[model samples]
Target: MTDTKYRKKLLMALLAAVLMAAMLCGCAGDSGDGETSASSLDGEADAGNRDNAEETDQNMELAGSEIGREFTERDRDSSYTESEAVQIELEGNSISADGRGVSVSGNTVTISEEGTYVVSGHLNDGQILVDASDSAKIQIVLKNAEIYCGTSAAIYIREADKVFLTLAEGSRNVLGGGAEYTDTDENTVDGAIFSKADLTLNGAGSLEINAEYKHGIVSKDDLVITGGSITVNAVSQCLSGKDSVKIADGVFVLNSEGKGIKAENTDDSTLGNIYIAGGKFTIRTEDDSLHASGSIVIDGGDLIVESGDDACHADADVVINEGTVLVNSCYEGLEGYRVVINGGTVDITASDDAINAAAPKNASDTGNQDRTSRQEGEMQPGGEALQNSDMPDEKESLDGEPQNGELSQNGKLLQAEELPGRELPQAGGMPEGELSEDGEMPAAGGRRGGQMPGGGDTGRGSIENDSNAYIKITGGELTVTAGGDGLDSNGSLFLSGGTVCINGTASQGDSVLDYNGIAEVTGGVLMASGSSGMAQGFSSSSSQCSILRVLDESQEAGSTVTLSDSAGKTFLSWSPAVQYSCVVLTSPELKLGETYTLSAGSENLEITLDSIAVSNKTGGMIQNMP
Candidate 1:
């Protein structure tokens, strides 16, 4: 073997070794990349599982919190068996007969025995039925509890003595399910507390009763809400008491299909009284807002009633002494036996009569007869007769018979004292004095009698005019705008004090001051205007007549003048003077082809241009001036 051949063989061997090592290293690098990819996939799966677990834990916590705060547990042993009588005590604390911190799951708790039972916790929840079974005497007090009854009333008491259910401070009692369909017919959940006894609510609490079919609070006796906020969204009556319902103070919001508050007595002898002394009451109903068979008295507090029917309907008197009462009704605003408004700001907007006090048609026939008799004449004590002896006699008297004279003449003789001294005339009836050259009587003792220089009717005094009806303005500034006659009275109109501005239009085809009564303005300033066309400014037909006498006897008098009546719109004006005139007509001087805004005092005068006739001589003629 040659030396070069041996060296070549060794080099080939070394090269072969290096190539094998390179191939093994490449295979190992590929295996490491696959392991890294597998590890990253596992880490992503673990992170996703952790996030899901956290979300599930959060949901469970929320559910637990809701359940813990929503309801309190009651022991099962505390359950009252069917027809079993149990007595529970409550003194501003929670208690259940089943046991403390135990939930009640039962059929019914029949209160058959007559005793006072106090329930501090939630009364009816989860089929825990409490049936009074028509017991005559039973009482239960529910304080600080949430009672929910599915397809049943939370608390039902029939013929009970007194069921005092008091919601704790900052707590509420919610009744009925959340469904749009009303369950009034069947399976209806009624009020949170329904009682046959005298119902009373006190303290700072709340009762939210949503009855889709029945009343929110129904009581056979008196229902007194002294304190607490009560909300009733009922399909029927909200608060109904057989005797009376008195609200002293609280926030009561009632939305009912029927009456908002009803106090109807079953017996005719017993009168139901609905008195709201103090409280903020807001009622929106489809029917009467506040109805009582006896009477309704609102002494204080703010009351707002919006009803489709009458806002307030009372069989007896409806008295509003104080408070702000706003009523917006489709029908009559207020209907009662006698509505006496002593104090209170009442704003009523009604489609029908604003206030009606007519006697009910269902009143007794004897009552109707008595009312008629009272209206006919006045009654004295012991029913004594006070005849109308001052009535005017409607008889005519003939001439008295002639006294026994010397010749027994049939006609009476005229005495010298009875005749005028200066008068001397012959049988031909010529004046004893001489006449002027123009055939006129002398200025001294003329052909007729002693007369003034001018030939005018001097026998008639200054004629006075009267208004339509007697309008007594005692106090308060009033501004009246009447579509018909301004203010009509059949008697004397006395204006004691206060300012009155009347803008009234007369009847069509009638005079403006077609008054049949006296307008005796004693005090206060009066500015009145009427319609146009043959309408006198002020007219009186009485013998005494309508005289505008100044309050201060020394202040003199004035005349009521008609300034302008352009297009049947009469504007009455007045000016002061020593001697008053009956009516003064003024023709306004309107500019040619220029508009003018005529005003009386501070009020704008309503004028019609068509009724104005522009005269080339004077400015224009306000035709048919009042």
Candidate 2:
């Protein structure tokens, strides 16, 4: 062997030994579960992550678990074995019981113990009363029962841990209550089926409730309906739950003179909510169809509402995760402090603002029977205003409201810092596109302040400071035909991914898109048309391109507004039900530094997408650039 060969083999062996040592050191640095060693510098960060995980678990428990729970197999069981049940037979104006816990009176039947009672009978004028121990759980299975109470609740639960009213399969039941409640003890019983404890209604049967005086089904605690086909006709609320109202799956046809469904607990922040996981609802009401003082969560459902007031209202938040909501007619379609639509199909036709994000004056009042109107001579919540007044003769605030005076042209009050040297008769005061003696109103998009068209401080901070009033549409298809502002947000409006088409008011005092803070469309298709006097374009913070054009003349109703590229291929088109003098269009397909053609009726214009937000006065109305 040569000396050079021996030296090469020795060097190779040394290199292999060094690599093996490095691999062992790397393994030692890990804590065997892919985490770093606790003694390392990253120990504090790992501890914080563990703490966050525990906090998230705690928050999830408090989120909606207190409001309601999904039905377990035990809750839906309507069949009780002979050994575990008590038998009660109801004869006309009399009753017979073969159970130890039940007793018969002249015309009423009372159950005094905790057990399952199968009731099948016809009661002409009597009541089924449950006066059990406070810690007892009771179940009353109604099978082909017809009950009526002339002066009290048909089925009243005075005390219990929880009561399950199970409608037997394939059976039909009817309960009718009188105009006055006579069973008044420690609790007021004003419903056909009134319970002081938590109540659960489940089964595959059907029940019809006719309430002559007050609510149809009243529960002082949580009220949950997992199944069954129920129809309710009431003078006041069809379903009133003091703590919460939760429906997992059911078919409901409710008609009421007051409200369709409501939750009226305001003492606790976690109570007074409504959660609908899956159901079918047809509600016609004189007031709001669904009202909650805390919050509302709609995971999946089909809701059709014809309401004299709002279709859905919540004092805290209204979230639609997935559902089909059709508001055929309403005053305000959806009103809440924060309205969020993650995914759904929503169609709204409203006389007032279609989707509003405004705080109610009294958050505790879920009924909202005394909402103030924004009319001439009426004052705002926190201040006094002149009757039929114009712009105040004082310095204007940064939010366009007068600082030292009481009148704002749009009838809203603001508590904002003063911004001097601004002229009177500010923008957004009159109806959009309304003309002055000079043939044009002031520039609507150049307002110095943010408040316009019911924008106020609202006790919530400005939009930049975590304001509670906002409209967020992450994904959905929203079509709004509104007589007032199509989408009005007092704080801000956010559109990330969705399709929004608004046909706004043709007259004065409203616009297609009105926001006090900012309207940002990062990824969405928005086609809005309305009056031009109070017109507004998207904010410059948006990533997409938009076109805001004021037409030369009013476009008649049913005139198609189209946006086409230079090749004349249309990309977007919509026909407004009402006349419009202004149009706003934006989409992801619209590219910056591109030119497009816009057509409305016989009018055509060559529009170049020059910037993120473009405002043009094509009809020689007024030229303002932002």
Candidate 3:
């Protein structure tokens, strides 16, 4: 109670009043202002985020491949008149020319100008040579004409814009070649009908060709067949068109020692193409049946091929829009980098990869280093050459195996690729250390990469493991039975729609479906059953899929596999589709985590999971099915 205590109390009361005034001003003036400012800022940030999301959605798209591109460069106009049919009769070693532009010199009947000539009679040792203007189109009508060339082609078209070989209605024609060809300084004519210009064969009648030299029909340019009934028997190749071979309608029976029908232009990558719109072909060959470089498109046909190698092979894409292809026996059924089967009824039985997507293999596909400087030539029967006066002056062999840089199968300008004993079988026929002079193994690998014998670097064989191969099916009804992988894509496999039944369990070393990249099944009916070791299934990145594994016991062959919903509604079913121990079923109808029953005959499998389907799958061995 003094003067100092009174001053201390007054100061403390003033300090408390000052603090209260500051608190009241803070609460009443701008305490909620920060929240209002932040609300506007948050709204601006959200607007910016929405714009980014919309921009991202617009920029996303899937890239397409070049597997199913349309080939529209086809010639369908072949209507020519046979006015003033001149007659040319062959007698012994001389020819009687009765045509306007025909002349006879020794055993050769030469046509020097453009005209229509009707040829009938037998030529024992002679030829019909057409040497006309560059723009002229010569038509030769065969009315029961039988010609045999002892040293050259029976019909030699040395120069012209194009030549048409027409078989007269109700007439039978024959053109045959000998074993030893008359080799010129720069050329060797080895086909029964050899032409330097574009050649077309059309008629409603039948013609038979026996090519004992090299090929049956050889054209340096394009070769087309509109309508005919033709049969070819050749020692090397049956029909070889350098630029392109387009067949609209024909009944062909081609039996060859090397290849059936080929269009190979190694000089120009886009020139070698084959388009078959309609035909009835039954081809038998020791090598590829239908081979090309650019593309192979079959619109509609009934093709039954029995080949030693691939049935249908192309370096580029192979598109089968519509056809009935039945490859009865083959090493590889169908081969290409991009194989697209839009619609077809294809049944193939192969010893190797049935439907393989791979890059082109050259003679240099081998790892051997001694590929260059290998010379190949056609030797006579007794290892000698017999010269003739009717030979060309520029014949150089196109190596026994194609080098992927030159046209190798023509007897007119580009000399045919000829070797000794080209007709012999080569599977496991070569010695272990000895190689063929063509720088290839006789037959080394299964289906692909068959080694060419000797120090040669090329041969028909298995495709080396590459990563650019793929298969896309838009629509088809394909049944592939393979001894190797049924459907093997070195890259990814994409299916939008199709009904593919693959029976690839014919071999134990491969799978039913072996893909190196993604295997996506968006919309399709895929029943692939094969070896368990390499039977990789669809990728998880696919949309709405299911994986199932049956346990307790393995399903036997010839059993029906049926799937149903919990309410006894059947969704998908397959009977006697394939043989397998470990099976993986994937489809869009599989509801995730749903209970379903899968039965193979009397064997039942029940599975319930969180996703479209469930499985307790363990890997098994790959064994060949009976």
Candidate 4:
């Protein structure tokens, strides 16, 4: 018998074994034609074998968006019969292929037909160029192939309906590019693997790519990776999908001087998005680890990122449904016009804001396009100083409260006349007093006017400039340690459920919870600690109880801060990683007209909750509260 027939029999034998195993499990049965019946698997289980828990408990349904579910049937298929496959072999600089649509000239091999092509052996300095008809679909199986091009991509797909590059099972493949591009074609090719058509990679093998000049892999259309072990090291972007990049399942290790993975199509908002359903990614880059011009959605993945700039940045919105995101180091952890974390485990250590929601800027106004060449600490192009319109009025207060109707500590409204000796900080001037020995400003007896150290205001209610921007954390365990603001929203902040712990900036200009609009927490456990100079707590409109306390002295890092009810049952506890003088906490368990004990290192205080939002920064406020 032929080798092809022998392999066909082996495949049938494996299918039979799988069908027998399914029958034994009572989940499926064979149809007597060497095939498992799909309907058999859908039958109701016997009472004795039924699971105690609902099936939904084991397999949680994906969100309504169902993002990145466009992979076609052919994109996920990697099987090929030996009889129908064209075999191409490369030995050093020599190549041999007798296929009808394959043309070889010197060391370059070109494919012009749609069929399964198995490529193997080593090419010293050659290219596998695919120039098929626009409607043709091609599949190239790399069976332990090694290819390198001196001045262009080793694998270039100029035209095709779609291409599937499958790494043959158990085989290892490598594609490398030189330091320069000598191609003068109309289409610029600048990656080890450049595809002008839609590209899909799926298989059970491994592929390593090295790009010395530009990107490791560039797809002009959509780029989809369903399976494979891919390692890419590039000078610019490790992976660049102009339209969209969707990864269903893969093992990726990417390192680049520029962006690790990015979608660059800015013309259409829906086209320039990234969606990762399942993957294991370790990315280190100088620019954003994952950037999209539109939106970025992480449904399921394990991403470990160390970036010189933002770890995950999107010009539109960024939504994390379910994933494990560990940003070991970054300039900003996650930034977008709208940032929403529904269900995930996110831990970020950043030099700037950990979670920031700012208005989207124009492409030219944003400096991230050429960030690799920009100098650190230098102002970006089109940067401008803060204008008076950007700051709130000096007389305004937080949460849109009128100047004369500011809510006092015990939920009683305080009139302007009630604060006789109160003084508002002047524009570009400090309060008329010297700093205390502990570097704290003396209490002004009542709430100070909304004013920053500079001419800008601390911002009251919704910021007029970026009113549409917001940050919403519905469900997640998010922990952040930052040198700047922890959770910053230029517009508003909404926390409905989850656990948020922030060890924020020690600098006086930043705060742990900074928002221009209302910061409302209906249900959640929040513990934030940072400098007291510009600290802002949850708005009085929140349903859950909250407290903002400014300590007389800064607490050292590693000091335990605990909050417990009158019965001494601890509900919230955290140890900050930086020295902090301000602490804010909110939880559903904290009720009105209840007493709680707050322990900060060596100091302890009993706080009586008289209102939904409590603050100790107002002097003589506790004495006046009935």
Candidate 5:
């Protein structure tokens, strides 16, 4: 008999033994054919028996080989027969099959009804393909076996009920296109491990997944990395999921050209949630290191992110209650809606405003409306006298009573006493001091006098000018080094408390500095010093010209006139209030390097000077000399 016929009989014998074992467990008997009816078993017996049988079957699937033994063997020289059954062992072992067509090297390795399986091992340089045309399940227990794919993934489960790839403590799985020199236009398969099921990584293990085009681990369901060291280096997003990718506790390092870990959902209602309760994660990417379209809550973990863009980005809120997050980015460090720093120290420095709040729209219009509404509410209908009913009669008469009932003549009814004494006379109306024609005040040498209105007496009028603005140093220490007015405010400057030191020059080097605001000293101390000698220390240019005059007689005395320009150049000098006889030195008009002589009643004064500063209007000194 041929080898194919011999293996066919052996497989049939193994199946017969398995069928007998199933029947002894109260399963339905098989009809001489390979078909068995599960409906004939007792209802409760069927459910309980199937559960126990499958559990026992999975455990006893591979029972024979020891470490470093061949898990299965297949005939590479002959055609496959129906009775050829590949035997798989549970111990550390390897498998070998045909290189071109479908080959099996396991006890009960089922495949998808219409799919192909490409299995490769690491210890050998050969690959095998197994094709199954019926719906079946395959469970693989890798122990001390090294699997490598030449140009495809190590294990490909196209369409199967389930595919289990387990790596023992000392086993490895490597998948990469073999080192070649051709740059052809052929599809090169990458990615170490690829699965289409809910992937779970448990036990103390290490998974190093490196891909050129795709990600390290691609799954359709949730990818849960419970406890393992998973290092994924991919061109695309490192670890992504259609639903969510959770890292409960593990050492996950992701280096990707795209986002390190992206959790997004197409549907808004089924948004993904990236919850990192505990893990040691380090992510470095060219884009946002950690991006989540949904919410990202880092309750506790060690996440270190370095990216070219925002470190941690989320479409919704990102709450960081407790964790040591060190982020260094070229752009904004942390950006989100209503960013609340309840705890933790976040040191951020940007080229622009470090921390900014969005400004309110229509700010000017809102402020104007608020002011107008406040003023309208404080309005009163009548004057003060009309509102006070308890005012005495003498007080009422003093205001301007209707007395001596002669109708008070024609135009004299409203006398001076009818108005307040603080009211000044109008320009073209009756002058309160001296009246002239057309009820106006007379000019200096114009009309003399006119009788006072209401036969009231007129006295000599007096005018006092008390219009000087000042700046008061209130609370707090304010040091001002400004180009213009040191401290200026339109309203009253009440310096309740604080110290203000102002070091400001009026012009370039001119000593005459001006303070355009009211400087009041209610509490704090103010130390102000001008540049040099340009007259007024601090002066106001307003109509109420407030000025703090610094009179230095020690510098300006006996001035057989000492004059210094803005460049500190001493120009011309002469004596003022002197009886001149020969030449009167009236305003020297000295130029650069020019000297002049003045004779006052036989006493000659000789003055020598250098470059005169025309910009500063500096001439000569005036003094009472012989």
Candidate 6:
């Protein structure tokens, strides 16, 4: 039989194994033809089955207290720059902002003016409130200060153009907030340190914030943290900035219930950006560890994260320039409409896909153009396999033959497909603009459609549906352990250089590396192991690679696999965490006409690069690259 025919059979067999596994797990059952029932796709269970309950319980107990494998410390000398010092000595129950327009009432000190204020001393059940001129620039220097607020923010900036919270060199300080808060006039605060204006946190000292209620620190505008030794423990979110969050340099340990850090501004698409130039972040959270609405750009940082949901998520785009990221646990490791990895060392463990490039189904399809292009009917003749026994989820749909440009599952414009159920009259006008190279509608396209995840009302969502979504790996070292799919993209996938390793033998609905559109490997080392059902190979390749299928008894998890040339030169080696029936390998040294022997534990096979497949044959459901 031809390699293509053999591969097709293997794919079918792998699907059979996956269906059995799912049934055994009591999560799902196979459709008659060995595919997941379409009815169960909408509300598919995402809960991962832990290998051991005792280990999981123990891990949950130490989730917040212990982070990443290595404990990190900060460089003290780089904390602050030399500046002017203004003293505001704290005495007993009384406090002062000194001659800078301030008044002390009992344990609380309110600043009605703006200026540089250096504070020292301890206060019980008190706070510092800054209510100044709208255009004023305020600065507070904390020097050996300890503050505890019973029912309000420890430091509240009710009104200010911008505020700078600085830590004095060599000093240690603590700020604590009560479990509940009392509203101040018409204002409502939700953080231990709350600010309604632009805020900058910088200094050399070690500072800690304890939030028993909402968040550790929150800024309504931009929040920038440059330097300090900061620790935060919050019942809700650790840090939040409504407009933007920028972290340059700091050492942060965050423990939170809701999220570790959030930058959400649905009111303005250009506002909710997250930029990290340099920092050390050790985070544990019940929700997403890092989330943003606009975009997340990490230039440099060290992130050790544990999250209940996605570890890193961005509605628009996620760009990793240089960083060391270790996601210990998560539902999904990394998610974005556009995921671009330029350079980084990333390791992830997840219950779902480790690296996903997905977007809302029709994020880019707006206007009647999406409605008019489809065939008017229920499901087509050959779509019996796509029918569902159960009612579909409440998806946003137009009642008609789609006229507005309809985006396909592969990020392309649909040609002639039927509606799932019913069809009728056409409504709406023409689509606004053309799709950009990045899968985004041009600026002229504007907003028109419905909501697209990330809790945003803006019609602009995943670029994947807009023809701009994809995974581009120019450089990086990414290792993933997934309970579901490994590296998956809704659109095209391009890898020019990098090393990618997948631990999961995706026996589910996807593959070790799944793509809706084309997948190309021009140069790089790609190693994959998975069930043969969806062990997809690249569409085209210029690099040396190998594709192998083995008996189930021949491959086992933790068994070392090695490949060597005829001259006994080692080329590739790996040890997978889970057993797999298929293995794909690639490297720069495996030249054509050179005989190479591959060993998986005790079994061995010999083949030449010319005889092996460097590029994969296109089949299944994915579309070819245009």
Task: Provide the lowest-lDDT 10-residue window in model 4.
Answer: 19-28
- Predict model 5's lDDT versus the native: 0.33
Top model number, lDDT = 4
lDDT of 2 by residue, 28-126 (tens): 122233221112111222232233221111012124325454666766665666567888787877888887789888888898888889888899998
Predicted structure 6: clash tally: 17
Pull out the clashing pairs in model 4: 461-517
| Deviating ranges (above 4 Å) for candidate 1 | 1-107, 110-144, 150-152, 177-192, 366-626
Question: Across residues 1-626, which tens digit of lDDT does each residue of candidate 1 receive?
Answer: 11111111221222122211110000001122111101111122123223322111101111101110111112001122323434342222233464322233252344544444434445343322334435343434344545555555556554454544444466665555332332433333345456666666664667788776567787777777767788989887899887778777789999998889988874752457678878898999988899887777777788888876667877655666677777744354555544445455565655333444434334563322111122222112123332334111111111323111011114433321122222322111233233334322332224221122232211101111111112343444434333323333212234444544444332121111222223333344445443331122222211111111111011123333334434535443554322211121212232223222333332232222221221101000111111
What CA RMSD would you report for each candidate?
43.2, 21.0, 25.7, 21.6, 40.8, 15.7
Per residue, candidate 4 scores C-alpha lDDT tens digits across 381-484 of: 12334233332122223243432112243654443223234432211123323333322222222122222223222113202324455788889899999866
Consecutive 10-residue window with the lowest summed lDDT within model 6? 40-49
Range of the 10 consecutive residues with the lowest summed lDDT in candidate 5: 617-626
Least accurate stretch of 10 residues (summed lDDT) in model 2? 19-28
Q: Candidate 3 local accuracy as lDDT?
A: 0.61
Which of 1 and 3 is ahead in lDDT? Answer: 3
TM-score for every candidate vs. truth?
0.44, 0.75, 0.69, 0.76, 0.35, 0.70
Candidate order, lDDT descending: 4, 2, 3, 6, 1, 5
Query: Across residues 7-94, which tens digit of lDDT does each residue of candidate 3 receive?
Result: 1122122212221111000000111321101111112212322332221111111122122223222233333454556778777667
Which candidate number has the best TM-score? 4
Assess candidate 3 and give its TM-score to the true structure: 0.69
| Cα lDDT of model 5 by residue, 113-150, tens digit | 33222322353322222233324433333333344444
- Report lDDT (Cα) of residue 215, candidate 3: 96
| Candidate 1: residue 619 Cα off by (Å) | 34
